[model samples]
Target: MPFWLSWAVWSAPVKKLGARPAISSGCSGVTMLNWLTAQHLVGLPGMPTTVQGVNARAKREGWEAQLRLGRGGGQEYSFAVLPKETQTALLMREVAQQEPAPAQQLQQPGAAQVVNSPKRDAYTESRLNDDQRSVMAARMVLIREIERMSKVVSQQRAIDTLVGLARTGSLSPYLAERAERANDRKNADRALSERTLKRWLADYRKHGEIALAPARRKPNMSVPVWAADFLKHYQRPQKPSAQAAYLAFQREYPGAPSLHAVQRFLAKLSPQAREMGRMGPREAKALLPYNKRLTDHMWPNDVWVADGHKFDAEVINPNSGQIFRPEVTSIIDWATRRIVGFAINVAESTLATLDALHSGISRVGMFRVFYVDNGSGFANDTIREVVERLGGEMTHSLPYNSQARGVIERAHRTIMVRLAKDFDSYIGADMDGEAGNKVHRISRADLKKGSQPRHIPTLNEFYERLAIALDEYNHSPHRGLTKIRDSETGRFRHPSPMEAWRRAEAEGFAALQPSTELSMLLVRPQDLRRTHRGLVRTNGANYFLQDLVPLHGDQVRVAWDYRDASKVAVFTLDGDLIGQAILDGNASDAMPRIVKDQDRRVSGQLAKLVQKGKTLTGKDVELRVIERPAEDDRFQQHLLEAEKFVALAHEPEADALEAPDNEMTRYDRWQQLDSRQRLGEALSDDEARWHASYPNHPDFKSIQRMYDHFEAEQARA
Candidate 1:
């Protein structure tokens, strides 16, 4: 063969002389090589250790000859025509001489390297099975011992000595142990043969340490016919166990294979295919590949994503004083990954979403685009209108695709979920079931008896904690944000969300600042109410103002703070601001009134109304005073005499009144009567009158608290 022809055959698979081939172990190390001079095969087993002797063997074997390409122009024999042992020895020497490139030179941040690269390290070792690693280690030991011996004696003589020691069981302890490990069956106690030791050295030299690993047979990937029936039972949304599915399959197909065989077939299925029917579309997305969202070009306030999360811990509702999980609506900036604003409400609603959005605008000004999922809270007209009014467009992601809003979804876990764990009342999915149940029972019991549990935070306290968490979050370093060089240290690190926002602001980024009046109009919830005369009626209350007079007898939209409905911001049907309206019934209801003032005003009005009623009834005449006459003794005597003829009937004894075991205070007496009335027990006439008067006592509140504590202690006992 020509030298170029031999080189083509040899280098085609490896691509380079020093590179390892991609073929399986059994087919490796069998490539044709370019022609070499007879002098290069001087030390092989079959060829004599002299140029003349190598030439004699080559001539006898009829090896093809080619002209030498470089240096001295002389005859060269084709490497393919050499005996098998000589050929193996030549390839092993060539493999052992190659050097590996350093890993640091090839490894770059976020870059992936090929698995078969010569720079094998711990990462490559992790991919091998324990058995393969053990065998590779043993082969390395043998190769090292050969290299060590070669320094003292000739390389061929060292190999002959080691083979003699192995056959006689006189090798060193470590080498004896390694010889057994190199066997196909690890515990066979088989001594290393001369051929086997040479092959081990050859493989290790070719592919680095990884080449020493024993070859693994390919698994039987062919699926049996019964696999389909087994899979039918296994791949269900209920996610039955393999054992359960096998039993079901056995019932349907009695001739099916054993469970282990079915399992082997299942193991061969790709992960995505195995879960085909075992999960819902939303859940199954976890196994599917996802495209990353790039925010490199986005700026602070460019896009804001909103989502609602139910707080995992229970808190006392401010209005009702009842234990419940508060819903937290979070608005996050996409570029900086900051939680700009959040609001806690009783539940998820459009109003809560709007409140959260308004808060974000107030903090960082209006965002350019409002991005959110297709939830009722974010996909409503009110939220849309608010975003539009703030000079932004509202867009909803595809339904059931919450992954698109990953920033906000991750925030819920990172911020609120972590915040919940700090509280003893946390009932998150990760909380222990017994501990959570105990908390629930204790909290409900205390609340039922009109007491607040210390573990359950009040709404205000929770708001304070949430605020602190958000501030810390905004100031902490975020991995998603771009890294910046620290001015003092001159090292690069991820910038905090707030730091990123400030930097962007310094780079001429300004959020849209809405006017105070417009912000108030946009954030307050709106409702349509009809204006009759000068009053706008809704929520069982009438709102009136002089400005509404022109819009009388027409329907208009009304906006008011949900926290306070006493004052409202009025608007026309065209969304034009009219004027503010006060609650028609009593604006004073919005404020506390002094007891003396209320009493004096009420008494005066009653007197005036009585006088007017008398006049209307025509009974307003005044009588003149006359002198008193002597008492009418005759009528008085007759009354006394008629009393003698009146008959008296016997009265039934009144039921004895039940009393408490201990002496009762005034409040206690009141509670006793109250409990009796609640339980359908009739009170004596005197007791009933006393009970009605007790509520007006000056110590009613303090005394009732004491009595309640006493009752609770008794109940617990």
Candidate 2:
């Protein structure tokens, strides 16, 4: 008999023994599923596909029969009264016949699309520790020996023989060793028992050798309040040690954890939690989830990002002979990771940014959008005007957020930082401190000593080297560009920037070209200026031409080439082209004669109106000088006044009233006597007396020490 038929036959008699009485599901009418003909369930599992076979099985199984209520009424069996296996098969078949939800759909057992999930037991080996794996391996060894011996005798007899041999220590060396190791762990008998061997056989049959791996207990994860407090101190910006934090916690709480306990508690924290407070905001951002910008849909010239970087290596200025790092302004295409244009300047400035834009736009046409940072070099009205004139939009990244411009920042490191390492004057952050200092000292010392430093390359040399490096970078494989298969190598690899650009070009991508007028308009700096007569004053210089005379007093826009400041391109306020104006440094007057004449005429007209109001004048007056009496007459009056006055006066006797002089006489006498003594002449009595008493003065010792010091120095020299 077929397997399906045999299963139906064996299960029919048992199902019929406990058949329940028919029961209704209590609906208003019978559902089509409640009463199914044998033919309706014929093709299901464990049921014969033929109607007659299914009916015969139903009769043998005592399935309750019902009459169909609708058209084509006939005897049908109650689906709810069928055997359990038959009902299960019908449910599975019905489910398979219906449409499935996309996410939860599963393929049938024998279907072409069936895919089996990996079993949990497949990774059992990985979950076991070394000791557990060793024990499992030993047990597997003994099980294999028993299986091999079972082929030669009855299964029980084989098992008994193996147990006897293991107990007597008379089995083969490998078998005996495995038996001893399998029983080596806690609470095991000295030798393998019959029951233990049977249990091992059953486990091997069910879950394979993984079932024999020793069980392991999970670690305790509960945190005490004291440990939590210690963690607060340990996880700080200062990053205190476990012991130090423990000490701090002990100061606040007498029940603080021990140092070792703190360490163990810290070990249980997640990696991200362990870094809390210990890392800066920027550094800690590495643990955060970031938004990834997708550039797969972008074309080569769709977006360009511009940034300025100060080169790490010092280069000598060709004009000034001074060593300094130059700032490089670079514009990169977001799609291909290619540097379309770049400019090098002594420092970051708006001019450098404009030059870089000109270089890029002139080569590859205008980009759709200009992405840049808020640096002064790129955030000015001039840059905005240049971008707008080229039919592109300019956007600025958030302040202090370099991550938003990570592409260009990374490019700086890859291109400029790598190039710096090739030069001897590299002073990057990662350069050896001693070597960097030595390079700095040498360059400065050489300049101070009036000699050029040979170690520092000139600006021109640096520019040439940078050009070569950029070219190499564009042609070399870049990891940031999309990966593609090489035709020649027949292997998958990342495409170079140039290769990616060429691929884009091959796919019919073309750049938007700027018109000649627009090109010229965007390449120079422009401003609004009002003309005086035929002259327009801008940038501290006056520009003049014959064509500007008619529009002298009108406001106009003027664009001047930085490289050629002698002339400026003039246009009307409405953007109509006027004639070019040349610089007029030799214009004689600060104001033109026409403007001055107009001013004079306006002054005369105002004066005429004011003259009509008043015409009054006043007469002049004369004055005379006062004189005093002559000198003889004045002297005669003074003598008469002295004769009229009378007074009594007394003077002290000069020699007796005079006391000995102190400060001034001592110094003067000392100087005079000292000079005389040095000349080998005799001193006067008054000088001798003063000089003799001067040594007893309170300031003499300090003055003598100072004199001794001065004399010693003079003598030594």
**Cα lDDT computed for each candidate against the true fold:** 0.69, 0.69
**Residue ranges of candidate 2 with Cα displaced over 4 Å:** 1-160, 168-211, 288-297, 315-324, 345-351, 374-404, 421-425, 431-461, 482-494, 523-525, 540-542, 560-566, 583-717
**Highest lDDT model number:** 1
Q: Which ten residues in a row have the lowest lDDT in candidate 1?
A: 645-654
The global Cα lDDT (0 to 1) of model 2 is: 0.69
Those runs of model 1 whose alpha carbons end farther than 4 Å from true positions after fitting are 1-214, 289-294, 318-323, 421-425, 430-456, 482-494, 585-717
Worst 10 residues of 2 by lDDT: 645-654
Per-prediction count of colliding residue pairs?
Answer: 0, 0
- Please write out the lDDT profile of model 1 over residues 83-120, one tens digit for every residue: 66665566444433423322222111121111123233
Candidate 1 lands at a TM-score of 0.56
> Model 2 compared with the native: what TM-score?
0.56
- Cα RMSD (angstroms) for every candidate in the order listed: 23.2, 32.6
Q: Tell me the tens digit of each residue's lDDT in model 2 across 1-717.
A: 784353233222222323322332322221224457877878775678898998887666555464545566555765545555565555434423433222222111111111111121644356457987888899888888878988988789889999888878898888877888876445556588787678777767865666665444323232333433455677788878778877887677654435666676567554455677788887777876688898999999899999999999999764456788999999999999998888888888898898788768766777999999999999999899888868899999987678888888988999999999999999888999998888888889987775667578766567657866776777789888778998867999999987899899999988776754677677777789998889998888898888888986899999885534567889998889897888883366766556578878977776655554333323333333356666445345443332221100011111323312333344455676788888999865655554565554423433454467679978987
Give the Å shift of residue 675 in candidate 1.
58
